[model samples]
Structures are given as C-alpha cells and as structure tokens.
Target: MSFGTEMENKDFKSTFSGYSKVEVDQFIAKMMVEFNSLSRENNNLKKDNESNQEKINYYMTLEKTMQNSMEIAQKTLKFSQNQAEKAKAHADKEADHIILKAKEKAKAILDHTNEKNELLKNEYDKYYNEFETFKIRVANFIEVQKNVFSTSPEDLELSPLDLTSFEEYVLKNIADSSEEVDDDELTLPELFDDEIDHNEDAQEHDDNLVKG
Candidate 1:
C-alpha cells in the first residue's frame, strides 16, 4: 500500500510521557515522501530490467536463426561443389570417348586409303607389263619388215611362181600380226607412233623400187 494511505489510517495514542505529536507527524511526513520516491524508482528499474530481458531474448533467437542459416548455406555450397565435380567428370569422359572414336575413324580411313592405293598400284603394274609386251611384239614385227626390205629390187627376180610365194608369205605374216592387236585394249605410246611412221616411209620407198 502507498505510505500516504497507510499514514492516514494510522492512529497514535497520546500519553502523559509521549513525544510531541506535531514533531512526530512532521518526521513521518518527510519519511513517507522519501519512501514514495524510492518505490517509484524501484518500479522504474523493474520496468527497465524487463525491457532489457526482452531485448536479450530477441537477440538470442536471432543468433540461433543465423547459426541455422549458416549451416544451411555451408551444406548448399558443399552440395554445389559435389555436383560440379560430377558434371566435370562426366564431360571429361564424354570428351575422351569422342577422341577415341575420332582416332578409330581416322585409322579406318587411313586403312581404306592404303588398300585403295595398293589396288591402284597393282592395276598400274599390270598395264605397264602389258605395254612392255606390246612394245616387244611391235619391235619383232618391225625386224621382220627390215629383213624383207634389205634385199635390193634388182635382186628380186620377177618370176610368176616366186612372186606368188613372196606375196603369199608377206601378206599372210602381215595379216596375222595385225589381227593379234586390238585398238581398244591398250593406248599406244609416242614411240610406237614414231616407229610406225618410220616403217611407213620405208614401205613407200620399197614400193617405188618395185614399180621402177
């Protein structure tokens, strides 16, 4: 209860030897004022303590929340790092696979090219050998003509029987040699053309001698 209300209800009994009422009342009044002031101050201090306690409680809750958030953030960071590593490993594996496939494809292409080159080489050798054989045959035919043409026209007697034998042998040999070669098979060399031109000139000279 307030000191003012308590003092109003208090009753002081007067006696013959009791202290003076006026002085005692004045002292009690001063003490009541000081007590009321101290009570008000104590109430205000209680209010301040309650407010400070509330602030401390809020800060504690905020700190706990921050700790939880930090934990979550760290976990998220670790998870992201793990995912990145996995992705990098997968990408590296894919790259290696691509490189391996490319190398295999390149090797296959090289092998095929080598095989094609070998076939072409074989074809060229076959054609070259055929060309050489053809040259030899042409040389032999030219040698036969040279042997026949070496005789002077004066030395060739014009007997009917001898003329028939000479014509039959020369014509038969020429026709057989001509039939052996087909124009479509092989391309004649420049040397063949030159040799053929030379033979044609010799044959023309021999015809002139026969006519004379």
Candidate 2:
C-alpha cells in the first residue's frame, strides 16, 4: 500500500527465502543496537527537561519570597512613620500645657506682688498722715504757750524772773509729787480738801456776823 508496507513485505519474503542463519542473526543484532541507542537518547532528553523545570520552579519561588519581604518592609516603614508623627503631636501638646501653666503661675505671682505693694503703700500713707497731724497739734500748742508768756505783766505779784524760776520749780515739784503720789496712792480731790475746808469756815464766820 505504502512504501513502508512494501518494504516490510519485501523484508518478510527475504527472511522466508532461506537466507543464511549467520546473516539473519547479524541483521537482528544491528537492529537491536539501533533500538537501544534511540531509547537511551530519549531517556537523556527527558532527564534534561525535568532538570530545567526544577530550576524554573526554584527561581519563581525565590522571586515570590523577595516580593513578600519587600511588602513587609514597606508596611513597617509606614507604621514607624505614623508612630513618629503621633509622638511628635503628643510632645507638642504637653509642651503647650507646660507653657500655659507657667504663664498662669507667673501671672498669679505678679498679682500677689502687686497686691502686697498696694497694701504697704496704703499703710505708709496712713502712718504719714497720723504723724503730720501729731506734728501740727504739737506746734499749735507750743505757739499758744508762747503767746500767753509774752502777754503776761513783767512786775506783777509774781515777777517775770520769779515766774520763770517758779514755773521750773513747780514743774520739778510736780514731777516729784507725782512719783510720791504714785507710791502713796493719793487722789487729786483729797489733796485739796484742807484748803477747801478753811475757805468754807471763813465764809460761815462772815455769814454769822452779818446775820447778827
């Protein structure tokens, strides 16, 4: 039918035509050798394909691992940045709070100082006013005393010289008398009782004579 079939039929005819046994045996050996060589070559090609597939699989796995590692690194970097931002914001808020507290305390201290200064100033003014009043009263009293002394007669029953000396003597006596009175516990009214009694007696005597 075909060339291959025709060749196979011819080969069969030749085999049956009583060829020599040595020649037939040699032909079978040559065919076996060719079959064994083709089978070894096919096995070698199959082994080479399997090795190449294993290398491709290994390289693909390595690529996937590198991609996963990159993703993890990116996520970590983003988280770190967020944490840093939060920390900075918190620090800024705390710093503002501290500054506000300091300002309030400083204001309170200044207010207290100002109040104390005002109080001290008021007390100084009050004391100064009282001192001025006392000075004025003392000066007026001294001026009145000077006028009285200047208007008094020179040769009256109490001479000027005597009055001056007597005033000093009386002042000294009064100081001494005050010291004695403090120790004696004497009252002012009781000290003048004898002089008042003598005056009443003289008046009563005159009234009796006038009535007679």
Best by lDDT: 1
Candidate 1 residue lDDT tens string, 1-212? 76667975677999999999999998888877887788889999999999999999999999999999999999999999999999999999999999999999999999998997786688567656665765766765676567557765545544435755555445444445665443332323433675577556656755764585
Query: CA lDDT, every prediction?
Result: 0.72, 0.62
- Candidate 2 C-alpha lDDT tens digits along 1-212: 74333433344344576888677767766665676677678779889989988988999999999999999999999999999999999999999999999999999999998987786678557556644654554454355446545655542336656656544433344435333222343233443453367456656755764585
Q: lDDT (0-100) at residue 73 of candidate 2?
A: 94
User: Per-residue lDDT for 56 in model 1?
Assistant: 92
Candidate 1: regions farther than 4 A off? 1-8, 12-24, 148-212
How many Å off is the CA of 57 in candidate 1?
Answer: 2.0
RMSD (CA, Å), each prediction: 12.1, 20.3
lDDT of 1: 0.72
